[model samples]
Target: MAELIGPRLYSCCNCRNHVSFHDDIISKAFQGKNGRAFLFSHAMNVVTGPKEDRTLLTGLHTVADVYCGDCREVLGWKYERAYEPSQKYKEGKFILEKSKIVKENW
Candidate 1:
């Protein structure tokens, strides 16, 4: 029989709390406040802080900080709104910094 396999996931580096599934990743090429980041279509076990307007490399956007639900460690940010029409596809997506997350079940 084939062995059962679990979903590949990314966990918080500080607390090992599952944050996102590998399948949910939309893009691996992104920049975070600390370093490299990944764009995910969905994130789990995380908390989003207050929304704020910030000017990024692409343009102005409304975003909220994302933290680990278990440890409260800052992971990245979620795109709340994109002012530029070209960047609208990122709305509602989550960004998780590579430095803040570790791979699991890979």
Candidate 2:
């Protein structure tokens, strides 16, 4: 099995917009309606979203599409609101595509 790890830095491949996240914050790999894949993160930075685009996603409330601050590339999204009590934990978190982000060391 893969051993549990700690925090690591990641960045946008197109513009180098970066964010740091603990391995624990990563939720799961999700496939969007547009057929795009994303890696969910409970914490992120150097992003600009959760303000411009909004839409209803699954059981969640209005989710915002996030972008890279430097290149305006659609990096991921933030779960702005949650409609269900169980989903409330996902609010304020981010969802970035693994393809869009590259590990600083790897």
Candidate 3:
């Protein structure tokens, strides 16, 4: 039988970009049209592109594409600014595409 793991870490599939640590995960397996993704309250070694207004999602005042720090591959997006203050917590958070990431042990 497969042992049950508490949780899994994720990295960019193409270049194995380590974005967040275990404690940084806000949510896992977020489903979308693209695919399942991991939501992190914090991420590291990510660069954001120019912020576009009212483009990606409604009420998302400013959003930008996030890239891997090493390979420059599109990994996820960073929400810089949002219309609601309550949503401001997600300003620096990331929604990394599962399809672009690989689950890692430890």
| Per-model TM values vs. the true structure | 0.96, 0.67, 0.74
Ten-residue region with minimum lDDT total, candidate 2: 49-58
Clashes of 2: 0
All-Cα superposition RMSD per candidate? 0.9, 4.9, 4.0
Candidate lDDT (C-alpha), each: 0.97, 0.64, 0.74
Ranking by lDDT: 1, 3, 2
* Candidate 1 residue-wise lDDT, 59-89, digit = tens: 9999999999999999999999999999999
Ranking by TM-score: 1, 3, 2
| Candidate no. 2 TM-score | 0.67
Clashing residue pairs for model 1: none
Alpha-carbon shift of residue 105 in model 2 (angstroms) = 1.6
In candidate 3, residue 72 scores what lDDT?
Answer: 88
Candidate 1 vs candidate 2, TM-score winner: 1
Candidate 3, residues 1-106, lDDT tens digits: the string is 9888665567777888677677777877564337777778887877888888754444555878888888988887877787887667767778888787776777
| Candidate 2 per-residue lDDT over residues 1-106, each given as its tens digit | 9876544767787866565454634555565545444545554555555454344455646677777777777766777777788877777777776677777644
